[model samples]
Target: MPPSPVVPCHSPVPDPSLYEPINTLKPVVPDVWIADGPVVRMAMPCGLSMPFTTRMTIVRLRDGGLWCHSPIAPDDALFAAIDALGPVRDLVSPNQLHYAHIAAWKRRYPHAVARASPGVSERAAAQDIEARFDAAFDDAAPSPWPGEIDPLLFRGSRAFGEVVFFHRASATLVLADLIENFEKEKLTRGMRAVARLGGVLDPDGKAPLDMRMTFTDRGAARDCLRQLLAWKPQRVLLAHGRWYERDGVEQLQRAFRWLE
Candidate 1:
């Protein structure tokens, strides 16, 4: 008889390992802010769970309307803090996997338009996740913040599509999962192993190996990358791991080097 497979036993990382001051606004630039939230255990290959630290980006438009990207789990204090910033006008899901919390945010801000990324609505419905969207993101930026924030669909991956944003005022590029830079100190031994294997650890983070492989059409992805670089972002904000505060273009180039 064949020997039983040996499964690794690893404890989940403590919540404190996540970004501090959870669910509160941390200023990234004059009009842009980021909020870190509780850890979400995402299923990994081999029957493992990878603890992902959730993050969300908020941009205050010139009209005093707040634009939220990849909103995390909602709480009263977080909502109150968001209200203080301005009226919630746009709640966005940057990618299909990031739409789980949009329903909660919609309940809190009924008037706010819940914008869905490509295939997000279908993904949610298949997962039986209750979420509604007033409109879907396209190659061009939508109204209310047209020139303020530019949106681009980073295509090529048939599995999922992510809408990346470039905030002109702050020169900040907002991303959901194109690049994940997990800090080693904040991870459990098991998670660190996984992050290392997935190529998502900080200082050399890029798209996870699995995700990079999905880009069968590198040409289309390259076209998207060119547009993002054209923006010449000064700062790069990501939904997971430590974000790049400077040299946005360089960081982007490094993260997506696989394309070349």
Candidate 2:
């Protein structure tokens, strides 16, 4: 049997629109799940902080070791619920901007290897954030979960890169920052305007305009996008904003239409 979708909790959140009942696993499919977390304030280049709704994906590998992607802020009850699922063996940081909580998770699961995308180390150092990774993702899939999950190193941007994952059994695609779909109602008026300007608001969310500017080599990004499309995922999970539970391929194509 698959793990329960949620664990009982009573704490109230400031914004239910941001996906309430936070920090509990919600099953997406058998052996695959997602946990929505509280909003995190992200500093922007414009000298202001932007609020982003956080989410994380969890996959229970065939061997019983859990693969955690872009783990959200750690919570005691959440950790206990995760403990019931299985042993955590992989803590994955999908992109340079999404590794903030890996250090904390690593401290809790010492045996789990923290894997990162390119440039994460430098980013952490520049930001003065302590993020230690035991392994780095490259062109080839790494050990432990290769046959079960497909890993892709999305290249092209010299300053930004992401390691995308696909869970074969669940037909789910896990991404960080590639596409963000913030629901308008969930966001404050100012944030909604900002999100609209960033091209990340729901129903039409794409890569942030600023992030798109970093991809000087659109060909390389297009190549990676091709691979992602070929995966034919049925569900797509994002680290921020609303996730697509169906029509994953269509959503991917829609989100990346800007690449064409």
Candidate 3:
């Protein structure tokens, strides 16, 4: 028997009209849309902080397929935008704990494949939702992105698994819930103090704390970090907080300094 279905904590959806359509030609990292034919990166700004803040990324495959890294409950307008773009090919629950809107996405896109980490199967089963994956991410796991992207599983801790994705064509790395970048003024006073103490805040004001908590074994994390660094990606797309542009690999090294 599967574990009981876990209903995600509910939150109101943000109005889409409030967001201005960002021109992709610009070079802003936070809400920049990078597209190369069928491969499109839509940087939707989240309401994590006031005055246009983004905490997650929604990637669109060539077939108009959608894949989200972070959980943001898709409202009608959001779904319409997704529909306008193309069909949602897959929904990935990168870690065990981040399945906030998997069920809803499954309902919305019934044909879309729902892939999750090891424990996600039971959670999906409990909810009576069917999830399909080519394989669970093991060491050096392969992604199902049809040669467009590759996934490397960073194994070292049991609390959660962080599957890192590398988009080959764009030389961009997609990370989930691992690194966070929040401006101090945008965060609440309490959060600011905690982030500062956690060494999440970089000199450029980026936060990597989201990825730091999952490392039960530093050795494993260090090895994974080393492997990821070898890719030499130019852009870093993260699920939480902000994405890094230029010197992404160096920023990643700085964030995972425990490995050093």
Weakest 10 consecutive residues of candidate 1 by summed lDDT: 137-146
Give per-residue CA lDDT, model 1, range 1-260, as digits (tens). 99999988796544667897799999987989999998898997657888889999999999999999999998999999999999999999999889999999999999999998899899899999999899887665454477798888898897868988899999999998999999998898888989999999998988898899899999999999999999999989988999999999999999999999
Candidate 2 ranges beyond 4 A from true positions: 1-14, 141-144
Work out how many backbone clashes candidate 2 has: 0
TM per candidate comes to 0.92, 0.92, 0.69
Q: What is the full ranking by TM-score, best candidate first?
A: 2, 1, 3
Task: Answer with 2 or 3, whichever has the higher TM-score.
Answer: 2
Candidate 3: global Cα-lDDT? 0.58
Residue pairs in candidate 1 whose N, alpha carbon or C atoms collide under 3 angstroms: none
RMSD of each: 8.6, 7.0, 12.6
Per-residue lDDT value at 106 in model 3: 78
Best by lDDT: 1
Ranking by lDDT: 1, 2, 3
Per-residue accuracy of model 2 over 1-260 as CA lDDT, tens digit each: 99889977886646756787799999889999899998889877666678889999999999999999999998999999999999999999998999999999999999999998888988999999999899988776464476799988887786788888989998999999999999998888988888899899998888888888888898999999999999999999998888999999999999999889
